[model samples]
Structure formats: structure tokens, C-alpha cells
Target: MNRVEIDGDRCKACGLCIDACNKHLLTLSSDLNAKGYHPIEIHDVEECSACALCGVICPEGSLAVYKEIKPKKGG
Candidate 1:
């Protein structure tokens, strides 16, 4: 499973992260940040693939993702 984390303080609300997500997993928040910019949000967590493109595109480094590491079975 993949999870999304957003750094509210660091986000610039540039919408770059929202544009980078091809899966349409991200959205712009209705509320504005302290800088008066709409923060990024994820509407559908299931659609996310943990690609990390949003985090890479974000200049403010406000986004991050963590994918589950499956365990290997031992004989």
C-alpha cells in the first residue's frame, strides 16, 4: 500500500504537484494556506501509485510518499 504525506508549512501552493500526477490523484484545496495559495490535496488515495512525481516536482519539497515493503517468505 502507498501513503501520501503533505507538508503544509513548506507547500507553496504552486499547483505543480497537482499537475504532475497523471492519475488525477491530487487536487487543490478549497482553503488557502498562510501564503494565500490553495494547498494541494489528494482526493482519492486508492488511485495513487506512490510514483513520487508530485514530491519530485514540488520545489518546496512539501510532498512525500511511502510504499509498503512486502516481506519475503522463508522456507
Candidate 2:
């Protein structure tokens, strides 16, 4: 499983993540953050494929991706 984390303070509400995400898993928040910008958020984590497109397109580099490694058999 993979998770997408966005830093509200670092986000500039550019909506780049939303556009980069082909799965439509990410969306811009309607409410403004402390920086007065609508930060990006994942609407559905389950639908995310960890494509890393959002992270790549983010100009501020506020996005971080954490991928969970699956346990190997007979470890």
C-alpha cells in the first residue's frame, strides 16, 4: 500500500497534483489552509496507484510518497 502526504504549509494551491493524477484520487481542498491556499488532498487512498505523477509535478515539492513493502514469504 502507498500513501500520499501533502504539507499544507508548503502547498501553493497550484492544483498540479490534481491534474497530474490520472486516477482522480487527489483533489484541491475547498477550504483554505494557513497559507491561504487550497491544499491538495487524497479523496480516496484506496484508488491511488502511487503513480508519483503528483509528486513530480509539484513545484513546491510539498508532496511526499511513502510506499509500504509487502512481506516476503519464508522470511
Q: Which candidate is the best by lDDT?
A: 2
Candidate 1 local lDDT, 1-75, one digit each (tens)? 689999776777788888899998888888878887788888778778888999999999888898877688892
Instruction: Mark the regions of model 1 whose C-alpha exceeds 4 Å error after superposition.
Output: 72-75
Ten-residue segment with the worst summed lDDT in candidate 1? 66-75
Model 2 Cα lDDT, one tens digit per residue, 4-66: 888888998888788899998887888798889988888778777777899999999998887
* Candidate 2's TM-score: 0.86
| Best prediction by TM-score | 2
- After best superposition, candidate 1 residue 24: deviation in angstroms? 0.8
Residue 44 miss distance in model 2 (angstroms): 1.0
Candidate 2 residue spans exceeding 4 A from truth: none
The clash number for model 1 is 0
